[model samples]
Target: MKRLYFYTFFTIFLNFYANGQALPITEVFNYVIGTNLGGQGGWVNQNTGDEVLVQTGNLSYSGLLLSTGNSVSFAGGGIDPQLPFNAQSGNTVYASFIFRVTDLSTLTDPNGGYFAGFGQTATVFGGTVWLRTAGTQFNIGINKATSLTENTWLPTNFDTGTDIFVVIAYDLAIGEARIWINPAPGDLEAVSPPTPDGTANLNTTRSSLNRFFLRQDSATETPSIVFDELRIGTDWATVTPKDPTFSLEDKFKDRFVVFPNPATNGFVNITSGSQAPKDIHVYDVLGKLLIKQTISGSRLNIQNLKAGVYILKVAQDGRSETKKLVIR
Candidate 1:
């Protein structure tokens, strides 16, 4: 009888583990629009001021799931909402979300401030994403720990009011952090990790991540932003799942052609069904724009690019297509 009872207890424990903490944590902010996010969705308000409120409409990307439901908006003040998760340790943990800046005109600090990050406590944070105004636009950056300023900033400036997918990965064992912005939708973690836009080494005092926090720092430093479809998991595929409804092949079917995919001689040819002049953009895996020019002919020069994988985007008329490119 004791042996039978032990077996029964073990089975129940297994069921709970499988259905609970073992799965990915996702928040679409499904609460009613205009409601305070702190009282709903298991988020605890850390302080008082302009509360993070559920805003109307969801942020969408072409090829990602979890785009349903409303998003939460952070205007300013101290109303930060922190949500706890199963403490993760000894491996890589990934967090992904759809983010957009609504206003940067009020930003007074030149260094900018962090809006979201992973945390061990309400105060201790890491893997933080930051935004700083650059001229009329803004730039996104990442830091590994509680640094006074962002460690690595993307060289490119992004315009406000545009939805962008962001993925942050932190390797606990190696004390390293990496960030990817607007990666291809078909990309999957099971095959390989996408190249990061920015990477930084973490501080020596590594700690387990137990929560994710949305912060509202000083009004002078933080920009007005909206965040939606926050997901946390143990791998990149879990946080950044490809949308089942989108197909890359069908979108570009018979419309464009890129030859010499693995171009060995530093030259590639492009042809389109319309036979119109094409505007070409070549970006490295890091999402950095390396080349931009208008081509009136079939052959384009790429002798300056190093041997590596890149993304080739061609635009003609009012339509555009992107494909993976390789140089050998």
Candidate 2:
């Protein structure tokens, strides 16, 4: 509500066809905890498009990272509800999230600790993205944040997490990627060169990933960023076209809806779009389909059904408009 804008870059639009629609990340993209138990106790929670802002908790490379003070954040964590966490790489990777810097005075890395982009290994240059504390420019290193040899520091003014927000896209298919800072909302420090019909691929190697890495500066200990509505493998979408003022409410995710939540008996309400032909299906926690129905409008009545925790699937009248819902 500070000052909002919208933009689509050309590098991303280059491969705009087929991508006319972005897949609902919360439905497919998953996260297996990197704990000693090998994700036995780790969790992977699906995202709800209602918010353009999803906060993940702390993250790490191998084995569940118990260190929280200076790591990643998850969208809805238990203690640190909105901290960094999920860090993984799969076939189709498109992780997009919005972040705002809260403080830089007390950083983990005094000289700057790989803000936005950080590769698994320092050898992979141009494989990371980062920003300097209270500084301008998108530090796009061809190889790494510290190694400028393969890095390209695209100068800009947006640096603070709250003052600025970025949407990152990693398409493993064509091996391309992009990170747009305050691209859509004007009057902020957004990285330049907007692309409405382009597609980009990242040179960051080292796959078998785990979570989205945006750690703090190595100089200090606490995080200097605050983010929300972190989406993966999809565009800055407008999932729900209804509620007229919907777009203005939440810009991160505009499609998919979970209704009648906080239920009492065993039914819930779900929908995909305002006026699109949709197919509503119910599935169990084990990925088993319980119900599938065709309907129109952004709201569907999911009345009589057994409840314990079912995954509600919805498909809009478009190509990619499916999402999962938890029945209470």
Best by lDDT: 1
TM-score for each candidate, following the candidate numbering: 0.74, 0.37
For candidate 1, give the lDDT of residue 157: 61
Model 1 agreement with the true structure over 1-328: per-residue lDDT tens digits: 9999999999976654333344388899999888899857667789889889898899876667748888999866679898876778888889999888888877778888888888766788878888888888787788898685437986556667878788898888887878887765556334566678788784644567777889998888788888999999988888887767667673344356788989999799998755667778899997889998778887889999999999887755433457788999
Instruction: Please give, for residues 1-328, the per-residue lDDT of candidate 2 as tens digits.
Output: 2232223454443333212223343311123323211111122222222111223353211111121322223221112111122333454344444445555555434333344442332223223455443433222222222443333333233333433334455444445445543333221122333442123342344463233333332335334455433444323442111223324334334345566665555555554325556556666778666676666544455556554676554534221223345455
RMSD in angstroms between candidate 1 and the native structure over all alpha carbons: 7.3
Off by over 4 Å in 2: 1-92, 106-111, 116-127, 134-148, 159-161, 185-210, 220-223, 234-328
Q: Residue 55 deviation, candidate 2, in Å? A: 10
lDDT of 1: 0.78
Estimate the TM-score for candidate 2. Answer: 0.37
> What do the candidate models score in CA lDDT, each in turn?
0.78, 0.37
Best by TM-score: 1
